[model samples]
Target chain A: MKGQIKNTLKGLMVDFLFWLYLFGCLYYLLHNNWGWTVRNKFILITAMFFTGLFFLIGDSLGRKSFLPTASTNRKWSHSVWGWLLVIVLIVTFLVGWNIVEVNPYKFFTKFRNAGGITSGIFDPSIVGYQLSNQSLEELKLDGVDQEILEKLSGIIGKRYNTRKVCRDDLKRILDEEEFRIYGEILLSKTEKNMTMLNQALTALAETIFLALLATIFAIPFAFILSFFAARNLMPHTFLGNSVYIIIRTIATIFRSIEAIVWAIIFSVWVGIGPFAGMLALMIHSIAALTKLYSEQIENIDHGPVEAIKATGASTIQTWIFAVIPQIISPYLAFTIYRWDINVRMATIVGFVGGGGIGLLLMQQQQLLRWHNVGLIIWLIAAVVWTMDMISAKVRTKLTSM
Target chain B: MSYLLEIRELHKIYEGGTHALKGIDLNVRKGEFLILLGLSGSGKSTLLRCINRLIETSSGEIIFDGKNVLQMKGRNLRYIRRQIGMIFQQFNLIKNLSTLTNVLTGKLGYVNTIHSLGFRRCRSDVAAAEKNLERVGLLEFRMKKTRNLSGGQQQRVAIARALMQNPRLILADEPVASLDPATADSVMRYLGELNKKDNITVVCSLHFLSLARKYGSRVVALKDGEIVFDGLPSEINEQKFKDIYGEEAEEVEIR
Candidate 1:
C-alpha cells in the first residue's frame, strides 16, 4: 500500500509538472497581451452559447453514455443523465455571463451613428457639393436674387455649406451620404466574409481530395517499397539496403517539417491562396501515408507472401494477393486519420494567407472586431471536434467489423 | 516420371549472418507427399521456402518444371506462382474481409488491377471461391469475417483460398503449428487427400515425427542446415534418427 501510494504520488507530480510546463510555454507565446478584446470576448460568448446548447440537448436527450464517467458513484455525477444536467448548467452559466458582460452588440454598432447613418465629412461633403451645384442652376433658371444664387454657387465651390438650407435638398444630401458610406462598408465586409468562407471550403475540399488520391497512389508504391525494405524479400543485400535507406530518408524529410511551415513555404512559391494550402497538405500527406503504408506492408504475415511467391507468383501478384489484403484496414484507418489532421491543419495554414478560417481569424484580429473573431473560432472548433468524433466512430466500426 | 523440382547446392545466409541452409541438395517428384522433419533452426522451413523462391538462396539454382526459377523474372515468375499454392501457421487470412473475400484473393492474379482495387471480381471467381469454401465445409461461414472464426475454421478458409488458385504445387510451412492436435490431424488429412485427388505436389515441414510418418510418402531429415537422411518413411528407425539428430533425439518420444 505504501509503495502504491508513493508510485501514485510520483505519477501525479510528473503529470502536474508536464501540464505546468506546457501552460508556461503557451503563456510565453501569448505573453501579457492576453487581455480581453471585443473579438475574443465575442468568441468566448459564442463558444459558451453553443456549448450550453449542446449540453442542454444532451441532457434532454438523456445521452450520458457519450461522456467519460467517474469511478465513484456520487449520485449526480455517476449517472449519464445526471452528468448531462450538470454540464448543461455549467455551460448555461458561462454563456449567460458572456452575454451579459461581454456584450457583442457593442462591437458591431460602435462606429454606427444613432440614425443608422455614418457620420463622416468626406461622404457629406461630396453629396452636398453635388446637390448645391444642382440647386444653384434651378435657382438661376427661376431668376431668384442674384446675391443669394451667387452665395450658393460660391459655398458649393468651397464645399462647406452647413446651413439648414431647404428640407428637400438636405434630405437628399443625407440620403446620398448614407448610401455611399454604407455601401463602402457593406462591400468591404462582404468581400472579406466571402473570401474567408471560400478559402475555408476550397482548402477543405482540396485537402480531402488530395489525401484520397495520395492514399491510392501510395499504397501499391509502398507495398513494392516494403518488399525492398523487408530484408526477407530481397535477394541481394546491397540493393535492398540502398532502397530502404532512400525511402526512409525521403519520408523522414517530408514528415519533419510542420504542415503550417510547409504552407508558408509553398505560399511564397505559388503566390498565396488555397492552391498553396493544397500542395502543402499533399506533400505532408504523401510522406505520412507512405510511412504508415510501408509499416503495414512490413508487418504482414510472411507465410502467405512466400506461398504466393513459391507458386511463381510475380512480385506484383504476390503483393496483390498476399500483402495488400493484410494491410487494407490499417491503410484505410491511417488515411482517414491523416485526412482529419489535414482538414484541421488547413485552417491554420490560412494564417500564412494560404486560405481558410485562419485567414478570417487573422483579419478579425487585425480589425479588432472580437465578435466576428469569436464566431469564426467557434465555428472552426466545432467543425474540427465533430469531424474528429465522426472519424473515430468510422474507424472503430471498420476495424470492429 | 520426370521430377517437378530440383535443388542443387542450395545455400541461404540470413541478414544476421546465420547460415540457415548450407550446401543442400534435394528433388521433389510430381504428385508426391513429401514431409521435411527437423528441430527448430534445422533449415527444414528454409529448404521448403527456397523451393518457391520465397526466401531467395544465397548461392544455388532451383529448377522447377525444367526452368531455372532463380533466373525467372516478371511475367514468367507470376505464371509459375499461379500453379503453386501455400498455407501458413497463422492462416494469414485478411481479418477484416469475409471468408469468401479471403478465398477470392487466390484468384487475384487472374483479375485486372482496376477491378481488384475497385473491389470488383469476375463472377466466375466468386463462384469458384464459393465452391472451394463448400469443399472445405465452410460455405455457411462464407460471409463471416475471418477473425470471427475459430482457429481450425480459419485454417480451413485458408485451405479453400489456396484451392481456389487451382495450384499444381502446395507448400505448407508449419501449417498445423498453431492448431490443436485434432485440428492438425484434420488439416494433414486434407493435405493428403488434396495430393491424392488433385495430383498436386506437396512439400510440408513438420515438428512431429509421427505426423511426418503418417502423411509423408518420403521423409527428409535435416540437422544443422545439412540433409542428414533422405529415404522412405519406414527406413527412419530410432537408431538411425539418433545418429542423425545426435543426443537431442534421445529426448524425443515417438508416439
Candidate 2:
C-alpha cells in the first residue's frame, strides 16, 4: 500500500515537472519571439488557456476518436494532424522572419555607402612612412637652402627615382662624407617602410602565444577533472556521484559562457591585456577539454580495466596502467585541437580590451583607418591558417601513434 | 580435503534480475587444470570473476587460499587478487603500451600508491618481467607495442604479464576463442605447460570440446546456470554432450 502511494506521488511529481517545462517554453516563445505583447495579464492568460485547450484536444484526438472503424479513423486523423503541423510550421517560419527583422531591400540601398570602407579594406596599407629623427618642418625652420628644400620635396614626391635623384643631387651639392650622411638620412626618411606590417606581425605573435599558454594552462586541470566527470569512472559511490555531478555541472556552466564574455569579465578583474584574454581562454578550454576528455574516458575499453583489476591492482593503479594508456592519444589530440580553437577565439577576445591583434584591429576600425584594419585582418588569417595546419598535422601524428 | 579454492551455494542475479549463476557448489584442488564448457552466457565468466571477487556475488561463500574472498574488502580483496591472475578473450593488454610495460603492470599490486603513480618499477620486478617475457618467447618483442603484435603474440604477452604476479592460479575466460586454430593450440600449449611445470591451478572456460579434452584434466559443463556435467574429459559421451549443449547442438572441431 505504501509502495503504491509512493509510486503515485512520484508519477504526480513527474507530471508536474513536465507541465512546468511545457509552460516555461511556451512563456519564453510568446514573451521573447511572438512579437505580440504578452505583458498584459488578460492576454497572457487567454493565450495560455487557448494553447492548453488546443493541446488537450490534439492529444485526445491523437489517441482514440469517435468513428465506426478505428483504423480508418486513425488514418483520417493522421492526415488532419499532418496538415495542422504543416500550417504550424508555416506560421512559425513567418513569425521567425518578422522577429529577425531581415531587410533585403536595405542591402541594395546601403551598398553605395559602404564602398569607401570596402575599397580601403581591399587595398591593404601594408607599408608606411619611415619617419626620420627630425621632422621636415624642423628642417624647414632650420633655414636650409631653398634648392636643398626643393630637392627634398622632389625626393619625397617622385616614387620611382627619389633615392637615385636625391643621392645624385645631394652628392653634387655637398662634399663626399656629408653627401653620404645626407643620403642615409634621406633614404631612411623616404623609404617605404613596414610600420603597419610590423605592428600586425607582433600582435599576431602575441595572439598565438596567448592561445598556446591558455591551452597549456588548461591541460592539467582538465586532465584531473576529466576522471571525476567520466560516468564510468565516477558515480559508483555516494561521494563519487556527488563529485561527478558537481564537476559536470561546473564544466557545463563554464562551457556555456563563451570565451569573449569571460575575457570581458577578466579584463575588469585583471586589467585589459593579453593576460585577461589568456585567462578567459584558459577557463573555457578547461571546461571544454574536461567534457571532451571525460567523454573519451567514458568510451575507453573496459577490458583493460578489468584485466588490470584482476591483477590485484588498486583502483588508482588500474587507472594509471590501463585507463591512462587508452586515453593519452585522444587527450593529446583534443589538447591540440583546443589550442587551435583558442587561437581563433583569442582574436575575438581582443576586441573587448583583451590584448592581441584584435585590439589593434578594433582601434584602427573605430578610427576609420580601414587599411591598417585590413593588414591586421590579413595577418590574423595567415597566422590562423598556419596554426590550423600545424595543429592538424600534430594531432594526426598523435592519434596515429 | 586440502583445496586451493571453495565456492558454496553461489547465486548471481544481474541488475535486471537475470539469474546467471544458481546454487553453484564447487572446489578446486591445487595444481589442477579445470575447464568449464558451456554456451555463451552460461555463467562461466561470472563464476571465474566471482572467484577473485571481481564481480560481487549475489549470495555465496567463496574461500580462496583459506580466506573468505567474498567477505574481503579493500586491501584484503586486492591482496587476494594478486595471487589470482585472469586472462580474457581479447588478451586485454594495454595496447598503446610496450610489451614490457604491460608485463610490468602485473606487479602493480605489490607496489605502493606513490610508486605506482610515478610508475617506478623495482629492479627485481623488471628482471622478473624480462624473465617472464623470455619464458613466453616474447623477449625480442618486449619493446614493441602490444597493438602491433598478432593475436597469438598478444595473448602470449598477456600470459607473460600474468606470470609477473607469480600467481598460484589463473582464470582464463575464453582465452583462445578469438585466435585461429593453430594459434589457439599454441596458446593452449603454453597454458598446459604452466599447469604442469609451474603447478599453477587453472580454471579456464572453453567453447571447443576438443581443446578441453586435450588440456583439461577435469571438465565441468554448465547449462541454464546449473552444472549439468562434471567429470573427467573422457566421460563426456555423445549423449552427455547433447544433454549439456541441447539436442540441436553439434560439436565443431577446431583443427
Q: DockQ for each candidate? A: 0.29, 0.83
TM-score per prediction, in order, is 0.62, 0.85
True-structure RMSD for candidate 2: 6.9
- Model 2 TM-score? 0.85
lDDT by residue (tens digit), candidate 2, A1-401: 88656654554344333344444445556766665554556544554564455444543222222222333245544644445445556656665666778789997788988875686668677865442435455567877667666655544443222245445655765668655655666655665657677788888889999999999999999999999999999847899999999999999999999999999999999999999999999999999999999999999999999999998898898888889999999999999899999999999999997798988889888987776777787788888898889989999999888
Q: What share of the true interface contacts does candidate 2 keep?
A: 0.85
Task: List runs of model 1 lying over 4 Å from the truth.
Answer: A1-247, A265-272, B108-120, B123-125, B244-255
> Candidate 1 lDDT, tens digit per residue, A1-401?
88656654554343333333333333333443464234444444554454455444433121232332242134665554455455556655655554467666876887454331222222221122123344456556777667544444443433222223333343443356543533232222211113333444454455445444544554555545555555444445677778877877887898899878888898999987767777777777777777776776767777666555554445665667777777777777877787778768777777886665666667766875443454455566766797799889888875654
- Which 10-residue window in model 2 chain B sums to the lowest lDDT? B113-122
Q: Candidate 1: deviation at residue A295, Å?
A: 3.0
Docking band of candidate 1 = acceptable
Candidate 1, residues B1-255, lDDT tens digits: the string is 989988899999998999999998999999999888878889987887777666678999888899898897777766666677888878877776788888888876555555666677788888989999888899999999888999999888888878888988888888898988888888888899899999999989887777888999998888899988899888988887786667665634433
Our tally of clashes for model 1 stands at 11
